[model samples]
Target: MKDLLGFGLRGRLREGYTAADFRADALAGLVVGIVALPLSMALATAVDAPPQHGIYT
Candidate 1:
């Protein structure tokens, strides 16, 4: 029972993960970030600023 909840409070020192999981998550995040970047740049330009300024701000 303790093992099921990570050894009764101390918790598991190591957890499981896979390369495919990481790659998929990273790819999805990158796609969303890239999509947001263009819209942000357009908004910044409308406000009379450089595109990168939107990214920084």
Candidate 2:
């Protein structure tokens, strides 16, 4: 669709970032990283490999 195709041109970050926006984005990234780290480690353990090996994957 036209909207989907043009979505990338609408940059939320480029529009003008306030301190709140930066804090929000950083917090979201941290949460995702926290959740993903254990999941990745569990996956690697399931395969009988070290947790660090998941990072390489």
Candidate 3:
């Protein structure tokens, strides 16, 4: 399972993830989430499902 999803924090820490990196990553994630929320809802709507399913998904 770990191999399948290779989001390794230990490796990132070893590679020196600093405060600036955290800030940048956080901002980037926020932007992506903002865009994805409506896109996900649109996808659910396209399939005739409730918009909330996008959040669960």
Candidate 4:
């Protein structure tokens, strides 16, 4: 995975990312989950159903 990102003639410019990149990615995913929560509720309500039903579907 690191080698793929670093692939290019400009090795210095395209250096592989560190552990910080993975951490940031994980945090972003969590934020996305939080953002989706309300939208999921609204969708289930629109269909006259519970939020967990929407999730299971």
Candidate 5:
């Protein structure tokens, strides 16, 4: 199982995350949110719904 999971499990068991890993995850989430912002608004408009509805989604 360890071999199958590979280097993702490289960290010490007691300290599972590093600061760099946290920063990278936060940046990735921010990017996805930015990209989704306009897309959600467009989708809502296409369906004749309020922009907030897509944002809620």
Candidate 6:
């Protein structure tokens, strides 16, 4: 459904941003960062940049 992937957030914000939404989004972001950080660091290394720059990016 469109709501599952995209438009739900805009609609929700139009209504209100509640505490539950903040907690859920924060948890999702934490999980995504844990999974993506290493891959990004590797990408930075392949590009000959320092690893920390990947986080800055």
Return the top candidate by TM-score: 2
Give me the overall lDDT of model 1: 0.78
Q: In lDDT terms, which candidate is top? A: 3
Prediction 5 global C-alpha lDDT: 0.84
RMSD of 3: 4.7
For residues 1-57, write the lDDT of model 2, one tens digit per residue. Answer: 454537654465468777898899899999999999889989999999998998776
Model 1, span 1-57: residue lDDT tens: 446655443342345456777799899999999999998888899999988888876
TM-score of each: 0.57, 0.67, 0.66, 0.61, 0.66, 0.50
Between candidates 5 and 6, the TM-score winner? 5
Ranking by lDDT: 3, 6, 5, 2, 1, 4
Q: Tens digit of lDDT per residue, candidate 3, span 1-57?
A: 473437887778779999999999999999999999999999998999999998788
Give per-residue CA lDDT, model 5, range 1-57, as digits (tens). 564556655544336777888899899999999999999999999999998899989
Q: Write the per-residue lDDT of candidate 4 for residues 1-57, one digit (tens) a residue.
A: 355655563574458655788699899999998978878887998989988876664
Q: TM-score of predicted model 3?
A: 0.66
Q: How accurate is candidate 2 locally (lDDT)?
A: 0.82
Q: Candidate 4: which pairs clash?
A: none
RMSD of 1: 6.3
Q: lDDT tens digits, residues 1-57, model 6?
A: 467648687787879898898999999999999989998898899999999888777
Clashes in model 3: which pairs? none
Candidate 6 or 5, higher lDDT: 6
List of clashing residue pairs for candidate 5: none
Model 6 earns a TM-score of 0.50
Candidate 6, pairs of clashing residues? none
